[model samples]
Target: MFCLLLSVMRRIICSLATQLVALIVVIINWYQWDKEVEGYIEHKAVLCEFMSSALHEAPASYDDIKGKYVFGRTTRPQFFSMLHRYNVIQAYTQKKEFVWIGISARPWFIGFAVLQFGYVSVFCIQLYNTVTRESWKAKTTVPLFGWLFGGKWVSNVHGSVGPTAEGHSVDFSAPFTGQSAKIRFVGGGLEFDVSGTVKKVEGLPSRKPTLAARYELSGSAQLPKEFLGLVFPLGPRRAAVVHKFSAVPLSRPLSVGIGEGVWHGMGHISMDYTRGLLRRDTRWCWCTATAPEGYGFHLSAGTYDIGGKSMENSFYANGKVALLNTAVGFRKVFEKMVKAEEENIDISSGDTLRWAVTGDGIDLQFACVDSHNGTVHCGVVDGNLNHSWGIFNGTITVNGIVYEFSDVPGALEQHNMRW
Candidate 1:
């Protein structure tokens, strides 16, 4: 009778264990399914609206104007709607307001529930480890995965700006002139009530081969709490943070070398200024000056979104004027190590009229010149190789003439490092 009782007890214990295992598996599958479904639904809605708005309507703005006209496909509200759809983010919209959200998950809860179950199926090993004093590896994988998936979210209200206008031109001295203001990317969740001025200096016939001047440009953006690490990543899974405010002042002047023909100073001079000249010629040359007293010219302002395989190159003789539109193609020309810096860099392309630009940087090798007495006093800086501090060298070729510029100044000091 005692032996029979022991057999029945063992059977009951085994049955209970089996039921527990089944229940755990069901729960795990259900949780994963739920999270995935939620993510999918949210992402679909966000992408649809975001793309649609960007293609059809003028970009939305924080404030409304009575008669001003704007053009773009997306609106501010539509953009926010996409962000709100994400479970990890919360969006807030208010006039003159900035905000951000923070998100993360608990480590311990994820561990006990998700990682350790794989070993549970090995009943014999479990039993042996429990009976013998052998160490059983507790699943520590879940907690590590949780930490990797979790992060903080933040936002801010700071002075910011975006691409307000898109067009082609030769002179960018006053590109912002008459152009309505708008915000582009609002990373870092910061906002600012900022204002700035644009100045211009025209090239005079009596001046020497070069034109020069200075300008001051200033603005501020409001910062949100811990709203860093939200910028568009420069590389895969890698992010940069804005640790502090950067302000830069620029100062620049144009220096031109007179060539043959009726060319006045550095740029082409024609009796009648025609916009179609760029289409016929392959190279051009011009110069410009900055505004204010000490500040330099800044070429950081403007947008260049060329279709794949081609690059957009522009020169600003004055603000809002385009001198040359050169199509840039990239090719490997040469590679060598700089002895002084101990760095391996390439001087990619052969000396030719072809222009090559990388990412946000621009490179323009003058392929044609049509301006007559167009001695425009424009800012000259190396837009391609310059760092955020405006420390780099650029090569320019005009009508079979070549020139090199380095450490060129711009309108805003903060923009010195940005190309």
Candidate 2:
């Protein structure tokens, strides 16, 4: 009888594995059309040319960038609706903010992100008046290294609220995918009133986001013409257009506080504004930066979807993008950093996390020295985000010219999203 039960369990496990493999193959073919593949090679060549031209200097802002990364009439929101509105796509919109600051004069930082996708959103903000700044004690996640670690810690003794994410109460519009979005949330440690509009910027492909907010402060971005873009397949069909820029000010001058304390600081904010028709159980790697070279790189690959086709592997630098279909695995290059600090490193436990990128002869590596910042934890039937911004070092060889990074600051992330 025991043997029979074991045999049945084996069969079930085998069946599940087989189904999983089949799903992956379907996802691969979904985005891998011959025409698209052919176009990709041309796009890469154009991107590399732009990168080569501006390899020596960094643009002050997106204004200083120009290239063939412009979107045509077909790339706009209206064009998509007109073309595929006939039950050809399942649209989804998501807005996420990741704020990590190098507080005051100390190396310590405290920050979190508010993630909203589909009908669910998670507020990772401690929502507290003033969070205690400590580096020794692991905040929520157990810390790994000392000097290399950079993140915020929510104290347990202070009896502070962690993060809150659940089904929202607001009305979701029908398949809205644009830079103009308005939303307000009230409750717990999270209360926000903000309206985002599109503003025309000089010398750019399109009008990006100009945020009008109540807390923190107003912000804007002249998003570059080039970006990490992908078009997914049919049946619960998903497509994504994502742009990332670094902004700041997670909290304001204690204006909307519940208990009356102080909350204000400055750090790098990775504002990921995206419009997509997402599939279930999808995963992607997305990271960005604004300084030390005005770099913006992203990779979107996952399980519900395969990374092999219609993938997002574009790196933006000095206002141009270089396509890297296989550069998503550049994190492996970070192995050298780990080996150098072997005395204090331990990746087996996942305590010593890594974040990196390599492309078209350009490679970067960094480690999440500490894991103080809590997970971008989302609820069930939703997705979770894991990313950390920290100091890193490596050499980027553009056209064989080496530009070294010395403790340069940036971020790296992996997200698994569901709709």
Candidate 3:
């Protein structure tokens, strides 16, 4: 009886040893994988920072600047992030093994692990679809990841410097920058239907001066929901394809229609006016993109700098534009939260922009000017909030000029696809 009891005791000890060994192995493997993933994420973050910075320094229009910079400017880093999203499933699998190590300690571990894996897997699949140029069917679906995991994955490393150009008059070229693209839909009691063509005459490098024309009429009424529906869907990926025909000259005291097709969408506009000793440099830029389902699926990894602030800003479908402006104050609304239903933005211009956004659509309203002398442009309407895939609508008044517009493209399209 004593021998048998000792044998049983030995067996139990062996079993416990084996289990401990297994647990240790699992932990080591998990640690290694976790380190790898963390490294990958860090690398991606760096690349995003570099791209954003480079693009900020790069001229908005590559007109006079040689196409060499445009071409030579490497997008390989951005492409790397795209590739990572494709491999995310494999990455998650490898990472989840580490999660299993923790699972052995608690009953809830298994459920948590499974849930995390599933969520990450879905996100990876959607991200892959977005980067691979799949059908637009998943456009709204993929941005949902942004709503779910945007804050965790992306860092808001930028912010807006006070007004770069407000009230100061300057000539605006055809909108070349995606964030800066302007579409004018004239409606409401507003005049000055000034649209003309200009050719680049001097101060250009390798490329020839191009000619562009702008034609718009402004009057205001309650903007139609149908038009709002179309316009709201186009904001996030807001972009335009400029067919260069003639050299367009933008001189001071000039307000040239930047884009030929004026499509207005619901988003934000920022103007900076600064006084300097040598000369006055004014910058007027607006960022508008569509978020149909309230969040975009693909991640925007790039660099941007308007004037004083250089940082990374990411726009999610949750009606939130993450501004990583180091020079200006900003914040991340949702952290570790799955989805955001509403977003309220208070701009430095003392304007409050509010959005009721969801996975299905978005409703946006802001205060603009009543006529053009900086009054209040306010109204409420509903449309496709998933504008990140190219849709959106809104009425905007810049210095008292009112425009009712729709169907403005998104900035993401410019980075990922050629539309």
Candidate of highest TM-score = 2
Q: lDDT tens string, model 3, 152-258?
A: 21111221111111121111122221111112212310111223332321121121324433333221121111110000001111111111000111111112223
Ranking according to lDDT, highest score first: 2, 3, 1
A best-first ranking of the candidates according to their TM-score comes to: 2, 3, 1
Off by over 4 Å in 1: 1-84, 89-327, 330-419
Give TM-scores for every candidate, taking all chains together and pairing residue i with residue i. 0.24, 0.43, 0.24
lDDT of 1: 0.20
Q: lDDT winner among the candidates?
A: 2
- List runs of model 2 lying over 4 Å from the truth: 1-114, 124-217, 225-230, 234-237, 244-271, 299-310, 330-350, 355-362, 369-384, 399-401, 416-419
Residues 174-221 of candidate 1: C-alpha lDDT, one tens digit per residue: 122221111222332221111122121122111122222221211213
Indicate whether candidate 2 or candidate 3 has the larger TM-score: 2
Model 3 spans with C-alpha error above 4 angstroms: 32-90, 93-391, 394-419
Q: What tens digits encode model 2's per-residue C-alpha lDDT throughout 1-419?
A: 99999999999999999999998886555444211222232354433433343322221111113411222111111111111231211112321112221221112232334333423333332111112321211122212221112122122232221221111212212122211112221232222232222221121112122332222222222223343322222122123333333322234331221222223333332344333333345556655443334444444444213335224444445555555545444343334434644433333234445655655554667655333222333454454555554555766554445556666545555555553
Tell me how candidate 3 scores on lDDT: 0.22
TM-score, predicted candidate 3 vs. hidden true structure: 0.24
